[model samples]
Target: MHAPRATSNPFVGLHHADTPLLLPNAWDHASALAMAGQGFRAIGTTSLAVAAAVGLPDGASATRDETLRLALLLGSQQFLLSVDAENGFSEDPDEVAEFARQLAAVGAVGINLEDGMGAVDRHAAKIAAVKSAVPGLFVNARTDTYWLGEHDETETLSRLDVYQQAGADGVFVPGLASAREIGALVARLDVPLNILYSPVGPAVPHLADLGVSRISFGSFLYRRSLGAALEAVVEIREGRRPGGRAPTYEDIQSLGADPARHD
Candidate 1:
């Protein structure tokens, strides 16, 4: 088996770099290679995109096999890969750990597991199991209180504390847009804080200033790509020129060639 690349293992270290790590989440081999071409050393897979591609529902544990298949396909690539396995595809901690083991064996350096506002202990068990199964894998334990519309600061803090204590390399809070709230969480958390980047939320630099260790563009790029394609077809039908830069056929084909190195 090929050894996991040095670039892949230092994914957690990227979180501690001078600036917050800006992770561009990709949906497929082409999107991943395209982002790597643009100089993103570490790329994450978006679960929503993975599920949508297979006509399955996201966050419903309906795409475990598809998610793993994507990971296996991208694991050998040059960029550091982080797989967003929604809820680890099962409620059983052992099953989640087994899945994480597979991801790591294939070359993924990190795994993002979300709580989805489930029981804190169950999520913690999954996190701990993953840590024990693959100690080197960076488990990004995510709490969706904000994304789920709970917005309970007390509950958020409580859940994060348990996740971190259970051995999450970092904690991700999606849908957290307030600078004050973000800063407060940053101050309180011991591990790296990963914030999902929202278009209307604080910009990258502001997030860095807020002490965010990582910023993930989760599903935004995938959604935008679809939106852009729709806009292009509509424009063509309306007898107007498409606005954005679309790559030539050859340019796209090149994405499947030799993967670009971070160096």
Candidate 2:
């Protein structure tokens, strides 16, 4: 088999901009291509959507094959792509490194690995191994202290420090919405700080002002899309029109056509 072609690596530079990079997460090709058609330079995969589509649980190390397949399909596309490989799908650091290599080989420019508040040493070792295996792949190290109910600021900082030392290109802290805390984390990290965008939390401009380099809508879009579909069905059943403009059949079909001419 031929080696994976090198991607242009535009994601890292996106962090240094005056404004924070707004990364929308997609579940499949249609979502990804549609986002890219709208001129989004970078798109990330939502692991929850991927696992749900296949009747599996997210963050349970069950969607490794599905994740790899999605990466292979999206990584070779026109835009920069990142895969959300939750905890690298294995406890073994070497297995995680191998998974990173496979993702990189398929043209993925970045990978998001979450610790799920597990052993810090194991997660750090995985990060180090992935970096060693694929130096070019942007490893976004994620800690779930806030999401998993451990809101200890000291623990969060300690894990981030270990991951950064292990060669993470960026640090992601989901469930962190306070601007003061976000600013403090950004100030403490040498690498770019990725914050999960919360609708009720700080706005994009506010986050940019707080020195957040990257903002991600993790699974929020996917969940909202499903909710919208259900709402539309309810409206139709009640003999009422759905609220928002729906995409036409042709418009939906066009996403699979010549992506180069999408715009």
Candidate 3:
């Protein structure tokens, strides 16, 4: 069954909250439900995890079907969902918008579209098409200026300006970590500014202090889960207990019992 639509879009308000929205990126149904069970109000799909789960390369637009399948499975759940659709799986503006429309129809409230350092006008066109196709979908326009290569302050501001004008609900800079620069961007952006959380950089409170509207843990949790599982098996082989929390089989079984779980 499809999830019933909420009376209003709650995702937009999340960015404007007193405290920044801490978005946990989940890979599969169990992980998403597990996070929702922990009182997270929203969950995002990590494209890396999604592609890696199916043995496909990320950022190559190879996980469109996998991404949609996961969305179909988790979209009916209680929490809001924002999918990390890498470049919308197409460079064509209309195609990207159609993909976003499909995502919105399945109950996703937001979509993260990265430019991948492509043409500024082309990415802006995709964003504009998406806004036109699904007006309610929160378009988190991402610019990979720092992610792909050296950080150019001028290019960053210019791309973000075009995206904002293209009707992006928010803007994301994934590799950005400088506090002063982040503060400067926050001071200039008219819409919400989303910063990908870096462990070596500023802490969550520090980002919030800098006026970041949303902080995303992109692929961090998924990678940690993999590391934890590998460590657990190695520890068992060495006749030692695992150092981290391992959910019981029954606990995992409980995750699928309800779409919305309460403490």
Candidate 4:
């Protein structure tokens, strides 16, 4: 298995207004390989999928090992892999820095670190530590201000300001889904802006037009895949073929051996 070229902070910054990063959220190696074959330059792991599949909880920082293992697997493949380390799995900056180091050692190119509605100063410190530990890893600093119902613009700006000053390459807003707000944020920030994709929310093209540099699917694809699998099982029980253009078993075998190959 050939490893992909190591990524830098500029790799994430390359995605921009006219060409936003269409990041596909992967649950495991096979899915990630499939999307990589389909021409996605970078792949992001979904925390919800990793947690749910292992029967553990999601976003409470219960999947550190799982996240690392997945990153190790994808790192050998021919694409940039970004691990979602929710809240850095601890409030302590040292632990988060260690986690970032593990990911960088395994060939991961980027990491998603979230505030998780924690203290802004603490999260900023964590981001700084992660950067100190893994200088090449693209740190996408996430703020959950809108998701947590404290949508105070002043406070949100203050938190992001701290993160950017602390050396975050990009900032992510998971639940922000407005063109006006997004435009304002993009115009104000010096670093790249990442927006989470919502099915009912703004589309990728719309987000690109609004000046978003990166668009993350988060857990949307993972949940949608689960929904699709359940629906397929029900359809089979009803004496009908399942939906989706699935690959054959042999195709999957080939992917296991070499993920970069589509056929």
* TM-score of every prediction relative to native: 0.95, 0.95, 0.95, 0.92
In model 1, residue pairs whose N, Cα or C atoms come closer than 3 Å (at least 3 residues apart or on different chains), thus clashing, are none
Residue lDDT tens for model 4, 101-158: 9998988888999898888899999999998998888898999999885676777778
Better of 2 and 3 by lDDT: 3
**Candidate 3, residues 103-177: lDDT per residue as tens digits?**
999999999999999999999999999999998899999999999957998899999999999989899999999
Top-scoring candidate (lDDT)? 3
Indicate whether candidate 1 or candidate 2 has the larger lDDT. Answer: 1
lDDT of 1: 0.91
Worst 10-residue lDDT window, candidate 2:
1-10
Pairs with backbone N, CA or C atoms under 3 Å apart (clashes), candidate 3: none
User: How many clashing residue pairs appear in each of the predictions shown?
Assistant: 0, 0, 0, 0
Tell me the alpha-carbon RMSD of every candidate: 4.2, 4.5, 4.3, 4.3
In candidate 4, which residue pairs get closer than 3 Å at backbone N, Cα or C atoms, i.e. clash?
none
